[model samples]
Target: MAVKTVKILTDDIDGTEADETVAFSLDGKDYEMELSSDNAAALRNVLAPYVEKARRVTQPARTSAKPASRGKSESGLDIPAVRAWARSNGWPNLSDRGRIPREIQEAYIAAGN
Candidate 1:
């Protein structure tokens, strides 16, 4: 089966009765489809399942081993302490928003007890 994609653009003009013009390109051809509010809602309903499926396919599966090791490594400091120390020294990218990055972790370990 061939994979097909739809690209859409929307422009809204202020104080207009029909404010939205949805321009979409399909099969290398461009066209504008005007939709009422109700139709737009219906289109969203139809596309919701495919959009969700695409999201699932794009995400990777996680393994049990990674989270376990990330909790605490062979290094003396646990993850939180390493993050704190990194911040105190004015280290770049100190936040543990995701996992503490590898370079910061290496710097922390290199500093030693």
Candidate 2:
């Protein structure tokens, strides 16, 4: 039998919350999972740094709006709500230059336009 492998884009690179267990690719592609888990440690290894960065970006444990570790506000658009929104709507590609998340949230802050 062939070692099954899956082609997950890794949410961190795609800019979402932490790593998500992908049952299948977003485009509905089939995966030949090599490990018992859908996305294994080896797979996560390649994406660990990005995942850590994203994890720190939207730390669910955080409850207050504070400056990001990267030196920017934590989505001025209501941290918790924006975190949920980003998770739901897909964390869009924004500049990770500390300003990106805030910039993206600015739209939400100014919503109803």
Candidate 3:
């Protein structure tokens, strides 16, 4: 005997049939939601301004250990200090946790930290 399975996606907001799945990240966490085309378009339109101005953070390729360890072992720099400095220096989008971006790290080092 053979069996076939079907999966259906429902809009997270309006409870209608979803046309696609949208994936996004916020505050270092990733999320996915199914949405109809109209809702998806609306979401994109709402985020267009911020998205246009935002910097894209590409994660490094992973190995066996945690990604944060790579940043620490390579530089031996203080993460919290960098975060504090960034916040004080007008980097509003820097999150308190997770590996700091390489550009920020370079800036921190260049600033004599």
Candidate 4:
């Protein structure tokens, strides 16, 4: 599934600060960093609260499910380029030349590559 939006909530239970006062902003916008500039350990007291809050968040739900179709996937039926050629040549509906589901015709053109 596509993630369209995100909501963030941070809490400080132990009066810890993740970063220095450099995190404060004008309109409730704050930046709390987990790693220091030198890639050293962060101040434990500061980051613990945000970490706990993060753990509370629920992950998004799973999306589409499809059962295994034996040999169908191996047939290359879902190949995007092959599908494009078939659709472009009036496979969905037979043209006046009456080529429908133009897989074999497409293979002749593309040599089934």
Candidate 5:
């Protein structure tokens, strides 16, 4: 016996069959949606002026596994040190891995550390 898998894309806006998936970003957030040709064209038309005027920024290539130095934030602060300070100061339940909350980062800086 043989089986085939079929994938269908429905337009996010109007529930019609989609021709393609559109990817966009706003306010530092990434988003993707399946859109029919008409809706996709409309979206492009609306954003054309802004897109023409906007500067394109290229993202760094990603690796499958994070490097050991990934703990450092974009601001170049030592994440391990921040975690240690947070744990000792007030955030005893802070996780050992993953991103540190923005509030904690701000507080760490505010405390002159």
Candidate 6:
């Protein structure tokens, strides 16, 4: 299953702020994480590549016939690249699943990731 979105919940419980425990959802499954501010920054640093890659979609230069097979929507990105892009953007669970769904493929292609 391809992940649709990532939802992060950072509300403190019982009005206590002792090392926040953030709750987030990936593909509908919920998980919690507790980390220091430094760790959160580190995590954002780790995810920067994926986020940037998704934000910037450049069509590869082709000098010969038979360019990379574009998707139905013609996103110009191959399937592997799409999957990797998704995984890098907080879709780690996709590794266990085979063949990204049509909706996800469409979104990935549409987003030019």
Full-model lDDT for every candidate: 0.64, 0.49, 0.87, 0.46, 0.93, 0.61
Enumerate residue pairs that collide in model 5.
none
lDDT tens digits, residues 71-91, model 1? Answer: 575554587788788888778
Query: lDDT (0-100) at residue 12 of candidate 2?
Result: 36
Clashing pairs in 3: none
Residue lDDT tens for model 4, 1-113: 88778533322323343232224222446555333322223444566686577635455887688566432334445544454566565555534332224555455357655
In the range 16-72, model 2's lDDT, one tens digit per residue, is 333445442323465543343334565768677866775232325866785455432
Better of 3 and 4 by TM-score: 3
Top candidate by TM-score: 5
- Judge candidate 3 at residue 112 and give its lDDT: 95
Pick out the ten consecutive residues of candidate 6 with the lowest summed lDDT. 9-18
The parts of candidate 2 lying over 4 Å away from their true place are 1-76, 92-100
Stronger candidate by lDDT (3 vs 6): 3
List clashing residue pairs in candidate 2: 4-32, 4-33, 4-34, 5-32, 5-33
Which scores better on lDDT, 1 or 6? 1
Model 4 bad stretches (over 4 Å): 1-66, 69-72, 92-112
Note the clash tally of each candidate.
Answer: 0, 5, 0, 1, 0, 0
lDDT of residue 78 for candidate 4: 50
What's the best-to-worst order under lDDT? 5, 3, 1, 6, 2, 4
lDDT for predicted candidate 3 compared with the true structure: 0.87
lDDT of 6 by residue, 7-106 (tens): 5544333332335565545565888776556555666687778777764445688777755444422544476777877787766777534557677777
- Residue 49 in candidate 3, Cα distance off native in Å: 0.5
Comparing 2 and 6 on lDDT, the stronger one: 6
Ranked by TM-score, the better of candidates 2 and 4 is 2
lDDT value, residue 83 of candidate 6: 80
lDDT of 5 by residue, 1-113 (tens): 99999999999999999999999999999999999999999999999999999999998988899557766887788999999999989988889988889989998999999
The predicted structure with the larger TM-score, 1 or 5, is: 5
